[model samples]
Target: MSVTAVGAFTDEQLELRKTVRALLAKHADPAAVRKAAESERGYDAALWELLCQQVGVAALAIPEEFGGIGATAVETHVVFEELGRTLAPTPMLGSVVLAAQAILASGDTDACERLLPGIAEGTSVAALCWTGAEGSWDTDNVGVTAQGDVLTGSSHFVLDGSYADVLVVAAAVDGVVALFEVDPAQDAVTRRRVPTMDPTRTLAVVEFAGATGRLLTSDGAAALERVREIACVALSAEQVGAAEQALANTVEYSKSRVQFGRPIGSFQALKHRMADLYFLVETARSASYAAVASLAEASESAASDAAVAKVYCSEALQSVTGDSIQLHGGIAITWEHDAQLFFKRAHGSAQLFGQPRAYLTSMKSAAGLTA
Candidate 1:
């Protein structure tokens, strides 16, 4: 949705989005992005420093008392939408959506104080360690066990886990949801990279064998449930941005490429398709905003709303990004074009936390469906 249409972004929020867009335009060049995605680091550290140290995007979600902008969920959503447009290889989502949110939501003052500043300033990177074969976000799926503050068991598909200095792991201790802070350097932990469709965003299989960990919180299953809902909201925002970008690229390419005697964009069939793509993107954006607003309200129905947004947005993004590639014809299939990058990102992001089908099922159950 356009800033003008949203009508909710204050001048400051608009300005922040503009600034991030311009920064990405300048720094995340096509070549640079390709290189970062292929690199071992999985993201650009220098670009991350510029965002955290210079531009202050990383600090936007942190509370003002904790050395951040203290922006609300809606404002944070704007920032993530801009970030996704660039496909900037950074850990903004992992840090803010997973780590920072867990610490803040846990009501652990010591942990927040110890970790927030570093996360805000780009000195520290953290990953959310949860996900298994079913790729479930439910508390029971958390097989990693915490015993007397020590954590053990394996967490698969930990985003950014390979490079993070700290890991916020969700585990079950006698069926009670537990949070633990794991140091990657410790001897008890081992991390192996998982090759993914989108290399820019890293994933890893982390094994915690009697890993020494600091207890972050023990609020039972409720803590993990809340964190999962928050993650769904943030992810939906990113998918909206990805879908929008893919559509924009297709439009730009259609206008520039000539077919028959004129630009392909002038063709009636192509124009209608692009128009439909635009509508889908806008609908996804609206759904995403609704999710963010509901999350901010923390309503009783927020979880269901977030799940609906996630499922719808993921499906929309998959459709839009695929059509974006197809609309570009053979050129989109080549490695030189950026269309493939977005297509892969869309595919990968769809499975993060859980895929569209999983969310759809969860949403149905949340609505009290018997079948």
Candidate 2:
């Protein structure tokens, strides 16, 4: 599919982005982010409530009937980008985007009606337990299995899994993948928080021992694929935003940080590097915007756009953050500086959903380019 220019943002979208940015600037500064990341819930509950109540961020993509703002992925993209800029740890990605989209894709009206309200309001958390220990996110590699209503086995790398009120699982059943809703509070269910390189995000391992689940969809491979595509697109926006912010911070530092006689950023070599980073950030932003546009429009090229956005944005963010560290010198690696946090976020996000190599391989296979 040929890449296209992103559509101009509507007035509301621009305003929404401004509102979210302002909120994050006020509430999720670097110190606040660090504090939240170290907290028990791994996020700022008060800020999350503010975002939900004021901006209606969690409700942006849900339909009106589901008690949402009846907006599109573009709106969610706006919010995700702002959240990425601050590396604010929140359930918006895992619960609002991943699990909510998975439930919507299941085409279970009753399930949507039952589950989406709390998610829309940011009052409840939901997690999608799909991948295994390998974190491949492949439909065929789903870790859990279902026999009748009972689920067994464990899923890893589950976002917000340790504290989610609802668990939407993709499990193998009779040789096919299906979606099941499991209550995390059930006696048969166990959740454990896992350590991660990125302190700004939370992941968990959920094990089910003959846990009873309510079937959402009997055939869920297609739904799972759809959710993955949407997730890739959404994540791409975050990567772009983070990359842009990283570059901005580096540039600002270059202007202020003096060397022997002048600012380090005034040096020709540093200027060139920053220029290259700028190019990467701009291109990645374009790719992310196009992907979100395609998804919002339900365009035929949405899947391919998502793939391109995921791979390109991941690489761009990683490259930007890596250079950011080098430019910032030893201070970048110190615990007191924010550069290290950006670097960690880049690496962690590159591995989230799936690695860039994984997406490239899938794209090549889909295009019949595989040997």
Candidate 3:
């Protein structure tokens, strides 16, 4: 379906999606994707400029007073959905999901003012340094330590950590959680890039030994709850986009590809499968939108809503992507096929806010289920 066919969004958002999709098509074509994935940096610098500096996608969520487009999370979701559709190689997830969110939610206006403009302008790259092993977003799980002005220990599975100029990291010290900024140029910090299931988005292990950092938030524990809320909702929205794209691709391919002298989509079996996937994607979208709406109200039920959306969307993306590849046949598994990219994105994103199993546990708890 064309982007405009999505009825929930505004005309401006539709135009924005169309423009960015075209930009990605021209700048991040197959060869460009291959080069970015194979290169040491894991993304195209020139294309980054075109999107962030010229196109203004990175600034979408930043307040206009701080050199941004002053967009809400819903608008940001639209931008990311198109990026996912094109599988564009950019740090949108890392920057917005991790760094920008941490800074914005930290309640450190000075820090936000100082850092966000550079991020919006594409002059700087920042990543949130946290371990996937931290599992859910509880601050008590933070293993990295910070004392005085120094931070120690390593953060594992850090998204875009290897490439970020600034690292907004979570750490614990004296039983208090804190957010610290680690400068990558400092010798006390070391980064090792890890090969990720999704090559389009870079991941790394960041080691800090007496790394000098500026503290941003003193109440890391409280801030963590808020940060996780934002991450979960934002991720849920991204999944909505990914799920939509996968279903659309699957349906489009099924309609065109022929077998036994007729379109395979005409087969009852495939039709049933596509129908199931469509239901899953639509349900996920509703859950995601509800969560986003709840977040805007700062509703006390935001955590539960976010959890529901996360779990639902995560499973939906996984199922939809699986069906997408299956429907596309063997061609989907090929490295050259866009289906593989969507597959990787599904796996990578599914685990970002804890796996579906973990969220399911949270969901059960939300439903008053006993441990």
Candidate 4:
């Protein structure tokens, strides 16, 4: 069945999906992906610019008034899925989806007007630093403290933080958790590139040594919760794509490789494994699509939908990628193989927004179920 039929995608959205896939096929081929993975920015600079400028992907979900395409969450998910399929590295998720949405939710019109236009134009990158030591979407653990317009303390596991033009930090202000926007170039703001499980994506240690900030929202704790929910949905969409690609590659390898004068795919064991992976992929797709629909409608149950999507999709992708390597027997672990890339990406992404169990717990709470 067509994705549109299953996910309620419009005709335009289906076309958008095709266009995104074609673009990735041209620019994000395996060689380019490997080169980008080793590069300093962790992505093809030219491809990133092309996607942002020519394809206008960075502006997909932003409002038209803020120099965006004024698209919906469905379109955003479609773009992310294509990115994931190729394992393309970019700041669309960090700058556009998470940080831009946080700005809009902040009720700070001036911040939106000034910052969001640059984000839509692809000239600026932003990272939202919400998690601290605990690394689980908890506001109480946010170590940064805001003293008037100055921010102090440090945050870890900040995604895309090393290259961001703007930093939106979740900090405590006068005992209330709030969102603070800071310029990363400032002397007081230090960004140290941190080792990550996936070098295709970058993380940083951000230290605010009395760094000056512009308050984005007084109710930052709530805004960050919304950002976490939005991020979970986006991350899940990517996981779904990655998992789909892993299964496809594994199946193709099984069909091509020969053993005892027959294709390895003929083995009953391999067939059973592929069937199980297919089921997981489909389940993840359903949950992720449901989250996208809920987010598009701004539904009251969107949080629960996002939690379920994260838990199911992350686990599914992790499992798919792990088996993808095993399905290849040994070649999958070699330096030249692309399967390892997907495996590393899946491993890192599984813990990106929140781990599977954390989201599962949230889902239960949202559903009023006992732990």
Candidate 5:
């Protein structure tokens, strides 16, 4: 798809993006972000409330019947982009996007009725436990096993797992994958927050030992695949936003930091590097927009589009953030600089969901191309 076709945002979307950016600017400055990341809950509760209550961000993709805005993935992408721009530590990804979408995709109306409203209002955080210790997020890598209605095993790298009110689990049942809903407060569930390189985000390891679960879907492989595609698209948007912000910050720094009695950005070598970084950011935006548009339309090519976006955006963000650190000089290495955080986020996000090489391999296999 052409960039013009997919990159054009509706007026309402532009306004939504503006409002979110303004809110983050006022409440999620670097200091506040650092504090929130260090908080027990790993996020700014007040800021999250404002985003959900005022902006209805968490409800954007839920159906109207479920107390949501009844919008499409495009709106979710918009919100995620803004969140990524600031590296805001919110559960929107884990609760609102991944787990919430997993539930919706299950075709379990009762589950939706019983659980969605709280998620829509951002009062209840949901964690999707799927990946194993390897963190591949693949169907074969599912960590949990279900015996009848009881779940056992451990899921690693679960976003917000430690404090989530609800758990949406993917487990193997009779050699088939299924989705289950379990209360995190259950006696059989144990969640431990894990240390990660990216302080701006939190992950947990959740272990279940015969925890009784409400089955959401017996045939969950299809739903899990769909959720992964949607997640890839959503995450591509985040990567694009973060890359743009990282490049912007680096450019701004280059304009002020002087060397040889002139701004470093005035140097031809640095100028070329910044220009190249700008290209990566723009191209990543195009790829993300294309994937979002395809997903919004339910296009047949959506899966491939998501894979492409995931690969391209992940690399772009890594490149931009790495260059950002270099452009900012030694100051970027210090804790006082936001460049370090962005760099860490870039590397962390690249590994989230799945790595770029994994996606590339999948894409090749999908095309029946022998490596």
Candidate 6:
């Protein structure tokens, strides 16, 4: 199904998409992007400000009462799609969508009041530190232990961990898994950047040695689960945008590059492959929109829909990005080629939130079937 068939985007959302694309076109071009990647922060501060202040992309889904645009999931879908299309480097995924959603879904007004405004205004960067060494989302996999208001243990690969001003961690308190808020600068807190396959996104390992923790909720397992589902949907939307662009670039390159006195794309085999990729892209797009719609309606199948979208997008992106490199041939293997960047992001994003296999299991569990 096409996006229009479902009426997924409001007129306002479409306007937002155009505005964000225009802004990214100006700021996120290849040369400018390479400069940002080499910077210490791994992103452009000025461009991030433009996105948060002028575009209000960070605040789109945040409620106005808490200093945001108070938009819906559909708006988020459009914004995420634009972000992925350009591979725009920003912390919106870690700060606004994932961690902020965890707080909001917990129904903790106090936490939102204290933490959300900074996120909405783009001043504070937050990340959720949930999975540990094992990289499992199951509550039982939580390695951090919270006793009273102090937390102990270590978390690995926390999103935006190296740059996060505030960290929302899932820790067991009183033998119940709960969400705890921590200040990264606390004396007992230790954080270091962990090398990542994709430098566009930062990750860090943080250890708490009896660090002070403020409990967001005594029972936040469900809230984290909900955030995980919605986050996968958001990332899937991004994967679609990125994959779509990769395919477009390949097609353009094929038309211009000649081989054997003919354009490579003119060949039957290459044309057939590109056709398959287009079909994959469209399937992913449909699944992404369906997931967004289900979540927006608060439907019973939201989890299942998100799972399906996440799994399909992950697999599609792998094929799309790999084929992008294959079609580009030798030039693509060079470090400076944009194809390498998309391929790297594809591999990185495939495992974000959870892998396709994990989401497949979630789909089964959601459907009351044995995984």
Worst 10 residues of 6 by lDDT: 1-10
Please, what are the lDDT tens digits per residue for candidate 6 over residues 1-371? 11442555667778888999999999999888778877777778899899899988888778999999888888888888988888877888888888899889878899899899999989888988888888776755676998899899998878877788999989987677899889999989988877778767777788999999888887778888889888988998999999999999999999999999999999999999999999999999998988888888788888888888888998898899999999999999899799988888999988887678876776678679994
- How much is the lDDT of residue 206 in candidate 2? 98
How high is the lDDT of residue 97 in model 6? 88
lDDT string for model 2 (190-225, tens) is 999889999999999999999999999987899889
TM-scores vs. true structure, each candidate: 0.94, 0.98, 0.91, 0.96, 0.98, 0.96
Instruction: List residue ranges in candidate 1 displaced over 4 A.
Output: 1-7
Q: For candidate 3, write residues 1-371 as lDDT tens digits.
A: 11221236667777787888788888877678878877888888888888886678889878887778887666666666677666667787788667887888788888888999998887888988865356565566675898888998888777778989989988987878888877899999999998889887788889999999898988877776777777888788777777887888888898899999999889999999999998998888788877776766567877888888888888889889988888898999998788888888889888884777887786778789977
lDDT (Cα) of model 4: 0.86
Q: For residues 308-355, could you state the per-residue lDDT of candidate 4 as single tens digits?
A: 888889889999999999989789999789899899999999888777
Backbone-clash count (model 4): 0
After TM-score superposition, the amount by which residue 318's alpha carbon in candidate 1 deviates from its true location, in angstroms, is 0.7
Number of colliding residue pairs in each model: 0, 0, 0, 0, 0, 0
- Local accuracy of candidate 1 as per-residue lDDT tens digits, 1-371: 22322437677777878887888888887788888878887888888888887778778778987777776777778877877887888888887678878778777888888888888777888888876645776766775888887888888888778888988888887777778777889999999888888866878889989898887778735667777788888888888988898898899889999989899999999999999999999888887887887777666777887888888888888899899889998889898889998889888888877778877776668779856
Q: List model 5 lDDT by residue over 201-283, tens digit each.
A: 89999999999999999988898998999999999989988999999999888899989999998999999999999999988
- Return model 1's CA RMSD, one decimal: 2.2
* Candidate 3 error regions (>4 Å): 1-7, 132-137
Using lDDT as the yardstick, the better of models 1 and 5 is: 5
